[model samples]
Target: MKQVPPEYYQKLEELQAIDFVIVELTLYLDTHPKDQDAVQQYNQFVHHRKKLKKEFEKLFGPLTNFGYSYSDYPWNWKDAPWPWQV
Candidate 1:
């Protein structure tokens, strides 16, 4: 497997963690949509997720595929050491 920097794991873990929270909060909001505090927290986490995603993509490469993320002329999605391979 190709070697990746330590920061890659750190940032990827952070992104995964925030993403997980967003999912949980989304489920919560679905049941308790009237909770303003939960709504606010959910929005905050979404924003943070976006920022972290950008940082990760800029440093590493596209972390997702399809419409969620863009690829340059020469796609890098198939690059060595996919997230799982790391």
Candidate 2:
């Protein structure tokens, strides 16, 4: 297993936190559809998540296998070290 930079791990951590928040907010919104404040917050987080994901993809590689984050050169997604391996 190869080592990844600290910044890469930090970004993944941030993205994971964002994803957790999104899921929690989704569950809350499902039960309380009339909560405008929660809905606004959810939308804001969604936007933030997208921005972070793009930055992550640009710096590291695609988080998913079939997204638009595919690289043109050496296919970093497949070649980069997996999280568990590091």
Candidate 3:
């Protein structure tokens, strides 16, 4: 497996943490829809996740097989190292 920079894993860990918070907040909101504070936090996390995902994809290729992360020149997803491989 090819070596990746430490920052790559750092970003991935940050994204994962944000995703975990979002999921937990979503579940909470399902039961407490009136919690405005939680709703605001959810939105903030969502935006943050999008920004992180964009940055990650730009440097490390698509995290998923589908979506806007696809590349045209050499099909980065095919050539880039997978998470486990790193």
Estimated TM-score per prediction?
Answer: 0.89, 0.85, 0.88
- Residue by residue across 10-69, what tens digits does model 1's lDDT show? 998998899899999999999999999999999999999999988888788888876897
Model 3 agreement with the true structure over 8-83: per-residue lDDT tens digits = 9999899889999999999999999999999999999999999998888889878866565667577677766876
How do these models rank on lDDT, best leading? 1, 3, 2
Task: Give candidate 3 regions above 4 Å deviation.
Answer: none
Weakest ten-residue segment in model 3 by summed lDDT: 64-73
- Which regions in candidate 2 have their CA more than 4 angstroms from the true location? none
Q: Give candidate 2's TM-score.
A: 0.85
Candidate 2 per-residue lDDT, tens place, 10-48, comes to: 999998899999999999999999999999999999999
Ranking by TM-score: 1, 3, 2
Report lDDT (Cα) of residue 11, candidate 2.
Answer: 91
Models, CA RMSD each:
1.3, 1.7, 1.5
Top TM-score model: 1
Q: Report the Cα lDDT for residue 42, model 3.
A: 100
